[model samples]
Target: MKSPGIVIVGAGQSAAVAAHALREHGYRGHIAMLGREWHKPYERPPLSKAVLVAAQEPLLDVLAEEAWARSNIELLNGSDVAALDLAQQEVRLANGQTIEYEKCLVATGGEARTLLCCPPYRRRVHYIRTLDDARRLRAALQRRPQVAILGGGFLGLEIAHAALAVGASVTVLERATSLLDRFLPPEVSAWLQSNLCRAGARVLLGTSVSDAFPVETGRMLLATDAGARLEVDEVVVAIGLSPNDALARNAGLEIGPGGGVLVDANCRTSNEHVFACGDCASQQRPGQSQPTRLESWQNANEQARTAAAAMLGASPPKPPVPWFWTDQGAHNIQMLGLPADDLEYVRRGDPTNAKALWIGHRRLVPIHAVAINAGSELRALRPLFDRDQPVQLQDFHLDTLNLRAWAKQQALADAAVPR
Candidate 1:
């Protein structure tokens, strides 16, 4: 019998990972990857950091061309899957071409959330969601334009860091009173704000753009809700991302709470043969009450693998402990597990040092850990999360001894690993 083949949509991080995973699992069936972008899949994290500062293009492939060729996975770039015919088990592209598949993976990511702007301001304002967006913004940054980043999230702060490195005057305006309000705790948010301020970027809180009018050829006058007007050469909006679940929803698939395609523990969507992962898929954690759609690069890679395995009739993979990191001008914030506003903070290490760990605990158990410039420590302590037993604070001191060795002495490995 001929294999019905698998069709994966949206050539982003998740799609690329899924393609490689299916091949790695010894699936010899036909595989097709469809993308809306003309360029092949590349890393998105660099689009905000390295890509912005580099003088030349950086090769940002999740999976290299040679590997794809060896794997025999067809890359159909510039083909947007406009609609999915669920009954026929096929997808119709924007160009009116339809392709049949036994199973499909909807890895369509998202677009940057747009802000209201005045006439002539639309073209001048920038939004970074893709490599092309970053390329254009990078070109504009060369002029050392006074850039006003319209959001204070990680992406916006990362861009500000890049702009500051290039000698551009940077001003960040956020709608909320604090930066990264949705994810980071208030203390972390203040720390980030102070760092940006120290890096010579003006950080404003509780302010949002009401309108942006173009008074000159390249300059834009932005009027804020607080009745303040700031004129800048360029404006970049990094407010947030809206999930690209239109295709899934249009196909009568279940949509999750956060505008994501709802999926189960195995990353299987409403349509059994059809799966979803990455930023587009919403999944509920074991201990968590609500469904979550993680937008981090870690989630994208992990979820893709899960979706690929499930499609191959393998048992569901174990859920991963959520981990994400952000690189500012001089600070690298690496966090393990989810951060909650109500969680009590247990400060570890020298508080005076800029590089320190902020561990969050719920009563006795260590629920989350946020480390600054402590990636190694975070990775070492990751196994602790798999254990049901609480990681005691009395075990060792940050003042001396190896944290990794001490952690192992506690027999974290002996603890049952949760799925």
Candidate 2:
């Protein structure tokens, strides 16, 4: 096999995006994406929702087989990289094959965090991090068994809703005092808790599984810290993920405090020819004290483009505002900007009954915003965060709020002026 011009270490979303971006930017040389998974690259978002509920597997392919061939991109699935020979500028696979590269991108992403207590009871406990994991969990859910979801984050909640759709009773256990407390404001957190309750999910905040034992009916008995005993047929753990940075770390590349491969604004790692992106990358953006690792789809795609541009020695566009969305039953929650606990929140309309918008700001200058079932309006108000503009409280009122109309006028006004 010919040596690849750009060797991408992981064949996940970031790897697919980077390979395509390199081609788009006119880097005509050979490109290869190496992944540990047997399947082609696909998105991970639908694993908990669509994959769990639907009989037909969702077509979430990032780079289809035909597309890869058409783009002249080689996809080496089920190829595990043992170590990186930085000095030799080569990626060594576990099978003793070495692939030389002009540039290397480490997009290994992350692995799901598992509990030490549940490893012994693998048959009853499940964790979703890959397509195969989702398929296995989905088959388990088809039995409509009582499910206990550990953690109240996006993945856990989505799984709860999916289980409910399949006639399964779900109980969500979160260790925090409130659901999504780390990323959301207190009031918003309360609002989400209420929604979960209304959707038939029994949410237990500040509770965690203390011990688990097999019961007579072949179900697991869970003892909670709150001194409550619960029996469930299946347990799904959605705690979080640990970055897959062992390859970079073993190669002596710098790692960030968040346990990710450290990369600069251009996604360039310690070695100029080596780059990192996606969930595995801890990025040092412009004007930030500490490096942060964002585990979102948008971040993965954006960083892929940035790294591709850097590979070709071209100027990359500025990173967009951090954004993420989660679909929980009837509600679609979208959050903009980096999460900050210090921001004061201003509410618009009722969050439980009707759609609502929570603007989190410091001294009235918008820093972050959360839209509950109001994505388009949130997009209209997105430009506000880019500029240092102070928003008046009165503008958020349902009777007066017309951000879309206001944004349209601004667009028309800007278009009328001569360049």
Candidate 3:
């Protein structure tokens, strides 16, 4: 006569998408989403880029106010989930209240990792995780603050770009030998570092902070592992993120690499009624060896939609090609899949060329594409990845590649379409 309640935990992008997917699939059951953040769900990408430079429109509303009301999905803000009692189908919140549900989704995403400096200097270190964190960092960058960034990853370089744009002198300390070494190859990392230097920011590789002694006038005398020292007005610690998968672990659910909830291709966890997605969920693709958790806006939305459908007895959507984008300074970096060691990558154009595209190939088969400000063209090549004949470099240079049209012929030639 009535449908059971479906409770979605965490109010981030994935949690919001889960609510929308449940309604889109015609599930008229009771739906509730609880988020720990004080504000309603907002996009986080701009936190490192546009939000730092200027104020913009709100990125809210996975389900707008009226949409939530009309769809009968309860919006519970500031509700921090503490524990889950799977046997009893109840979740205990931080306020000591238990909410009952027939099915639960854990989408509590990750948090920005902080520095391990002196206890008193913790407040001096800034991290950008939420809207409020971004706002605070933006305010601190008002009058050209000398900024010291502690990492050389995408987020760190992004913040460095923003800081440099506002007339701030920036110095980045990266423990690794190259910038974005973990994600990008040496050639790409060199290009990014060159841009950072050209933008009036100093990039220091193989360097780390030993101590941050507070000096007069809100500055810190920083000591480095490489025997260097500098005083900066503000410090940004954008090292990385740690997944928020403790609730799933507490419920005795299987955990994957990097401390994320282990879920299958269908987003089902060890518990039959429990599912997880987004940065908090770790999964292994068919061809991959190690289980990985992707932290991107695309992953958050797509995985949640799939997990919600599976929970509602619907066929899951086809998995995507794992595309992600980053905006740093004035460049738009779009990537399809990550750089793999086994794949031999080829660049369509020279690195000095503005419209260059990098394609990774293994045995002459396309596996990945990395482009700068060439997103539309890069996206068109997705269907042709490892499915068609080896793409010719001359075709890419001459702008004569019609990947979509070529992929259409694949069904006739191979009798199978990639999902």
Candidate 4:
């Protein structure tokens, strides 16, 4: 019998990883990757950081042409999957084409959410969601312009960091009382706000843009709800994202309350043959009744691998601990495990020193150690999340042989040995 063919939608990291994993597992069937963007599957995390700083050449391409060709995966770039004919087991493309497949993976990611307070004001604002958006924003920053960011979330802060690095003045206006208010606690937000301000970016809290209009050359007039009018060169909106679940909804697939395609632990949608992952799919965690939809790169890659394994008739892969990292100015911030609002937080190191550990449910769930460059410390905390026992907090102190260092050393040694 011939191997079943698979069709993967959306040419981002998740879709690419899924296709790669399927082939690696000895799936000899035909594989096709459909992407809306003209470019092949590429990495996005660096678009805001390295790509912005690198010279003319684009740094977002995750898989080179040679690699894709060698993998024997067909790439359909600059094409959209309009509809899924579940009954016929086929996918309809935007260019009036259809492909038959035994199974399909929907990795369509979300689009940036723009504030709709006023239609006219929306035209003057820009959003950072794709490589093209980053390129445009990077060009604007090169002129050493004054930029206004809409939301004080991670995206806004990261953009601000990039802008500052390129010598552009920035003012971040957040409607919430604190930056990252939804994810990080109040204290952490305060620390982040201080760092942003110290880096020369103005941080505005509890403020909303009332109106925005283009003025003189490289200038814009912005009216705020706080009865303040400000002038800036450019405006970048980083409010949030809305999942791309319209196709799923049109196909009569189950969707979450927030419009995300609902999927089971195996990454299978309501229709068993149709699967979903990445930002668009809402899959519940082990013990949580509510579904979780993460917009991080880690979640996308891991979920794709899981979907690939399940599609190949392999047992479900173990879920990796959810980890997220953000680069702001010179500080490298990382969080491991899901932090709860009710959990007690203890500072292992001085926040002024930019190093600390967070204890949750009597377990050291989050290790936040930041310095001029602390990528090593961030990598050290990844395995601690998977440990069966709670990591002692006292070991985090630099002076004493700390628990974090000892635990990390042991982990490194264990990883070095062959299984």
Candidate 5:
């Protein structure tokens, strides 16, 4: 019989990071990772970008074979976990096999939200969620067909950009007034829309596909809510993501408000032996009222470290400010902190040239920031957002102000204060 140690369900970014963190935390025991995917753990960000445009297969593997072998971590790929037997502290697989574990981390992640109006039809419709999904879409895009993206969110814009790069006619349909309206400042959203339009792709705002049907031999017809018809070769859906928490819920783990395994500060689920992280875990942070499932690469990595520490009974690291980024068409937009609608926006540089940083402040306290092709400057600004004290606008009022020096000074000042 194999010795039981830490068993992580779902081999994605969160699972891979948790396994590596365990070894980093000086854990030398039996570690098994079961995943439904055929390939080893890979990153998801490339699925919408490089995977679609490149002819060569992108290196998306998070952990190499040698790393797993060196750590003696058993990876059970293509194994579908049917249920979590909480009573027995075992993971029951679909093939009638059970793996007992001292502790289990559920990082099942999420699935792409599909549209009811445009279901998959003979490969005419595609959704970029898994590796297989990206491969299929990549092959389809190679034909240089007209591509219609269903959403104007990060993924949709990214797919549109990729399609355009491959000589495919692209059109992005968004139901909102602007791209990423809820998250970005109005001016920034406008700039994103303008950039996409300049890249030889059509961006339709306040429009939604009401119906989709086959039009030609290898094409699809999409009807818009605004009474317009668009004939396209492929339809890509990027609406949102739905958490895969059925295993946790069926096993009697308390789920959060928006359909994720409810976890506390330490990423512990309702059952003490089981924990959840990544997109599958919903958490109510220190100041938030409602638990939110953050679907970002940074969140997944940080939460995985936290879950790993908690499993070892070690002190978990403090959560940092929420950050997300997207790359599309000569622009790299990075956002820091949570979204708030009432904050005032102050710009430090010109956004038209794609070198600017916008700070959202409330009562002279920086809450959020958006960096347009200024990632390094954005990193320097983190000290302000991480700090609890209010900052004077004069510190960064000048466009030529050295934010790096300002950040270093603030760090020194913070360290000088007695805890």
Candidate 6:
């Protein structure tokens, strides 16, 4: 019997992983990937960090050109999927090309939400979602220009760090009272703010831009709502993201409240043959029925793997513990497992030194440690976050709770038989 042809839309991490996994599972069908960007599928995490520092490193391409060709996956770059005909199981591209597929994966990721308070920058402003955006932003930074970031979220802070690294003066304008208000608590956010300021970047909280207009010498005059004015060379917007669910909605597929395509645990959409993953799909948790969407790289990669397996009628692999990490200035913060708002928080280490663990539900749920070069330490504590056997706060000896010892204890405990 002939295998089924698989078409994956969106050439980000998720779509690329799905295409590779389908071929790896011995599927001898035609595999095609559609990407709107001119470049091949690549990782987004490095765009804000390493790529900002070095543009010629090819940070965006997640898969090598030679490897993709060897896998027999036809990559259609700079092609947009205009419409989806669910009834016919076909996708129409902007170039007037139609591809029939036995299975389709929609991984069209979200776009950065620009600030609406001021008029458009007209080629003067930039957003760092695509490789092109990063290239332009990097060029601006190379000029040793002054940068005014519009938001205090992760993206904004990451960009701020990169600009400062190149000796560029940065001023971050945040409407919120603190940075990273959505993810970190007040204390944690405050700690992050202090670190950014210490790194020579000025952070303005509870302030928003009233108007931004081009001025002399490639500079912009920003009128603040707080009766202040800022003159900067360029502006970078990192407010948030809005999902690209228009394609699914146009096809009459069910969408969630926050503009995400609704999908089941198996990553299947309302139409069984069409699947969605990454930042585009809104999926329910393992036990909870409430719809949720995660924009982290971990979620995107894991969901892609699951969607590919399900399409091939293979047993899905167990989902890894959801985790995310951020690199800002000289600190490396890693968050393992989920931290709920209602859950009680207990600080296990010193915040000033950038080494601490947050305990939730009286258990070692999320560990966020920061240091100059603590990548190894952060990776070590990841496996200790076992949902099945929750580690209580008392089980952690703050002084001696290194990564290796913690992992050994958790392994022994998990290995023991239960009554």
In lDDT terms, which candidate is top?
5
lDDT string, candidate 1, 119-233, tens digits:
2137668998888888888988998999999999999999999999988999999999898866766667778898899899999899989989888566899999999999999
Question: Model 6 over residues 159-262: C-alpha lDDT tens digits?
Answer: 99999998899999999988876676566788889989999999999998888888877678888998899988888888888899899999999997677999
**RMSD of every prediction:** 2.9, 3.5, 3.3, 4.7, 2.5, 3.4
Clashing pairs in 2: none
Q: Which runs of model 3 end up more than 4 angstroms from their true locations? A: 1-4, 55-60, 63-69, 118-121, 386-419
- Expressed as tens digits, the lDDT of each residue in 228-345 for candidate 5 is 9999999999999999999999999999998999999999999999999999999997446699999999999999999999999999999899899999776898988887878888
- Give one digit per residue, the lDDT tens place, for model 4 in 182-221: 6665567788999899999999899999887767664678
Instruction: For candidate 2, give the lDDT of residue 27.
Output: 90
How much is the lDDT of residue 174 in candidate 1? 90
Q: If both were scored by TM-score, which would come out higher, candidate 3 or candidate 4?
A: 3
Residue pairs with clashing backbones, model 3: none
Q: Ten residues in a row with the worst lDDT in model 4? A: 364-373
Whole-model Cα lDDT of every candidate shown, in order: 0.84, 0.86, 0.81, 0.77, 0.88, 0.79
| Candidate 6 backbone overlaps, count | 2
Deviation (Å) of 237 in candidate 4: 0.2
Model 4 spans > 4 angstroms off: 1-4, 56-58, 64-66, 117-124, 216-218, 362-375, 378-384, 387-398, 405-419
lDDT of 1 at 364: 44
Displacement of residue 329 (Cα, Å) in model 5 is 1.9
lDDT of 1: 0.84
C-alpha TM-score for every candidate? 0.94, 0.94, 0.92, 0.88, 0.95, 0.90
- lDDT by residue for model 2 (122-173), tens: 7878899999889888888889899999989988999998889888899999
Which candidate do you rate higher for TM-score, 1 or 5? 5
